[model samples]
Target: MTSAILVSILMTLVAASTPILLAALGELVVEKSGVLNLGVEGMMLCGAVAGFAVAFSTGSTGLGLVAAAIAGIATAMVFAVLTLSLTANQVATGLALTIFGVGASSLIGAGFVGKTITRLGPVFPESLSGHPWLRAVFGHDIVVYLSLALVFGVGFFLRRTRAGLILRAVGENDASAHAIGYPVIAIRYGAIAFGGALAGLGGAYFSLALTPMWADRLTAGRGWIALALVVFAAWKPGRLLLGAYLFGAVMTLELQAKAAGVTWLAPELLATAPYLATIAVLTMMSLGRKTGRLDAPACLGKPFSAS
Candidate 1:
């Protein structure tokens, strides 16, 4: 491929990777706080529709993102109330959340189908964003930069900060954390809220930044892939970046294949490339986990209460 073509592909890959990385980073925090929310896909859907509707109506991508985050937090509260307060089964509750998100989004977005809006433009001006070499550094929208920044932020928060240390304490042993007056349940609620908000933002990225349109199920199964990516990275932020880019490359390859109309592979198979890679990565991680090498949070998925 020519340099220009390569640059274009790289740009697409970055765009594709950002949402997954954003969603996975949020989930990493959720898991680290000892909660497993499977409703990420649903939350993303809520965010997608909410963001699109607001942005499309108000002519402000920024407002749409805000609406998406609220929608996500609202949806996540359902899971938090059930799993945290009522102590529902985490697995079952999570599955239900995903189902609810799918149906609710469809209902909410029924009228939004086929609608289009202006795509989010680059953050930098033409002088930088349009330059041959500098374009790679400045050619993307704000969300792209935000996603990269969050990676470093999360790594720092989880490893360097004292609050991060406390959150870890709760995840490692909720009872112990509570005994120390850390308010275990409260910290978890905050984590879940943060996760939901990020998932929402990630979902909004699909409609506002990537496609700049409204469509039901627009996020497809990327939320699930994000969930899988957390496992693939063993819950490390740095590795999460690597894994998101890897999947991004897979998605880019699929897009290139479809664009070229390559007859060597079936079109349907190309579409499944990202999911297939997710499954393969998950399988490898599972096998390695058989030796107890996995670094999962100790209290993950376990219901906790102050009582």
Candidate 2:
């Protein structure tokens, strides 16, 4: 019984962490290419609604994921055009994107309210996923495994590949990357799109895997947590995983407390726990800046143009 309880908690931690890790990995790539997209929250919302809508209508999780990715990409393009092509402020545009996403997703998800669908389940057979001891490893949906794979894949892509070199160079100094004959704007565009798709997938994870239903602001500011996670990870994929799970555990505490009917802790304080963790991370980043431990992309949050 004790082991079973432990496994259940582990599963909850993995589920909560997966979305944040996925979103942060994409943002890591985007920041690596010198773009700071604050629109992760908005893009995620757009993806959540889009994924839920498509999946609900078609009853295919795969198609719903595709639609979510497409929605993320489309929404990301708006930021790309404004910041990359027209040279708008990346920060302001990102905030606008989040606001737009919140409003748009609320509008779009209105019909989906109170709707529930079959949660995305593990790909493997019940023999594994339902096993008493193996469930922790095999019980989760595919998104959980994919998110883990992405951690290594992203770390490798950024650290080992020549293309990764160029992307980093673009982030470090786009003017130099451009002078060396790299397409700065194009690389950033691709990075932004990739970020969007992942953010969308993460968003869908909430609807399809986590809660399996729709509600207004279903994501509940996880996108912002994802944004801080990139910084907490110090732009490294491994650290991002740790940060994500840490935050996830913080979030899980609230659920667990409520489930156990713990009366000592206020629900409001529990709700604030995750956000407080976010603030602590952001504060760490700020403090690290003083100690010179902060090493973000030099050109991050800066607008880039070929001209």
| TM-score of every prediction relative to native | 0.97, 0.97
Candidate 2, TM-score vs. the true structure? 0.97
Candidate 2: give the clashing pairs.
Answer: none
Q: Which 10-residue window of candidate 2 scores lowest in summed lDDT?
A: 284-293
For candidate 1, list the clashing residue pairs, or say none. none
lDDT of 1 by residue, 1-307 (tens): 4877888899999999988998899999999999999999999999999999999899999899899999999999999999998999998998999899899999989988898988888999999899876788899999899889999999999999999989889988999999989988889899999999999999999999999888878899999999999999998999999999999999999998899889999999779889889999999888877656489899999888777
Worst 10 residues of 1 by lDDT: 285-294
* Candidate 2 residue-wise lDDT, 139-236, digit = tens: 98888888999999989989999988988999999999999999999999999999999999999999888888888788999999999999888999
Please report the TM-score between candidate 1 and the true structure: 0.97
**Model 1, residue 88: what's the lDDT?**
99
lDDT of model 1 at position 44: 93
Model 1 Cα shift for residue 122 (angstroms)? 0.6
